[model samples]
Target: MEIYRAVVARVRPLTASMIRVTLTGGDLPAFTSTGVGDEYVRLFFPHGPDRHDLSLPVPTESGWETPEGRPTAPMRTYTIRAVRPEPGEIDIDFVVHEHGVAAGWAAAAQPGDPIGLNAPTGLYDPPEDVVRQILVADLTGLPAVARILENTPEHIATRVILEVPDKASEQALPAHPRARVTWTHGGNGHSPSRLAELVTTALPGESDLTGTYLWTAGETTALRSVRKHLRRTLGLDSSRFKVVGYWVPGSDTWTERWEALPATVRAELEALWEAPTDDLEDVTIVYEDRLSNLGL
Candidate 1:
């Protein structure tokens, strides 16, 4: 666990509403990654009368912990879009939406501005055994989806569904012969081809899913709904999919919402949303034991 200090070296617009901030500094040599494709870090934004230097927390075994009585810095998590060792820089992409500290800062970020970050950790990786893939995302998950596509094996069959606000929001992505990407755009909160519906339509029949994996990110409600259908309706095993929410829309109180889901739904989506890991040996054992008992 380590905290990093970076200076914004460049800002580039990826799309009409998406921005990329490239950070580089001497401290970047110490900035490392676990090399997992979905690795991410928390960017700390300085605030309040007592703190404005963008002071970041020191790392401990438990994680980065802030000291008591210091004004807490507003922070948001983002995926590691690119890591360049030659230039010693990392790229983080931001999709501008409603005003918030992270979005607002990115909207006006300039070269030489200060930012702090920690950890590029997550449990997502291309499954060695699975040769078929499905990727579903909203605007927030576009960067992660891009990373997965660029890194996954080229021979595997892959289908991608992306939800955006409009055509202006679609950006050019890397190409793969086995991949087909569809974009759904709307001016409203979700497009007509919403994440849940598009994923359902793309899921293969039971007989076709032997070597398949599904990765989903974005709106919590849509993602949870998809997870429920995949688990309870399609009877997909717990080991078949990996999921996470980019952000909960319109509210910061996520724990309250989690407390309200039906126990069964919560049980299936909870751990993946909270702490997904690529080491499925541990997860597979726990789930296999459970599945066998139910004759699955």
Candidate 2:
């Protein structure tokens, strides 16, 4: 729940669709890293009429909050590409798009621009006995995927399937001794995502998944389909795979509808989340089904 303040120190283009921003500040010296490959943080940005007036959330006993009469800060989650503790600096890679607040900020970021971020949490945990790692992602999740490749153990064979908009968007990734990478062009906001389909074709049979681990992240809707296939259709255990949705299309509209829901309906959704269950996937299925029924 701790927040760290930093200023943009450098900006550079990584590829046609990605940019890297380097941040440094005194507060960054105290920042802690989880040391997990897919670790991420919630980045806070300036908001309101004065774009330079940073609007970071205030940490309270309950949680973070915004001051009364001030617009909530514009925040987004992003992977920590690299951390250089000695210099009190960290690198964040962003996928540039025509219509996202975070993308816009990254595209125009200048040195000395202020920013804030919370401590990181990670999701890329392969079991101790895992012999092979299957990593999947779209452009939005590429940074984390790259980090995972760099952190994978030498004994584990890795299979990477990356979906980028085009060949130009792809970059050279860290080399793994036992890695096989396949790149497919298309489906990164320009068209429908084929992440689930490609992953399905490459996955081992249900009976052969014992010592394997699967990790994937991308658009929310696309990931839901992947989750359904792995959990329900394949009957895969939740502990064997980590599936995360990095972004949702039309999020603004979705938020508006969610906020307008009746209190009782909201409580129902909360109960679904809090209910005890052995498989988290079951909870997600029911929660998302209810949201779809309400056109959320």
Q: How many clashes in each structure?
A: 2, 0
Q: TM-score of each candidate?
A: 0.82, 0.94
Scored against the true structure, residue 270 in model 2 reaches a CA lDDT of: 92
- Per residue, candidate 2 scores C-alpha lDDT tens digits across 1-296 of 88888999999999989999999984898999998998999999888545578978887786688888877889989999988888889999999888777888889899988888998999888888899989999998899988899988888999999999999999899999999998998887789999888778877345478788999989777777677778877788888899888877778687888989999999999998787788778889778777768876
Q: Superposing all C-alpha atoms, what RMSD in Å does each candidate have to the true structure? A: 6.4, 1.8
> Where in model 2 is the C-alpha error above 4 Å?
49-51, 68-70, 204-207, 260-264
Model 2 clash number: 0
* For model 2, the run of ten residues with the poorest summed lDDT: 201-210
RMSD of 1: 6.4
Best by TM-score: 2
Give one digit per residue, the lDDT tens place, for model 1 in 80-143. 8888977799989998866778888888888888888986787575557888988888888889
TM-score of 1: 0.82
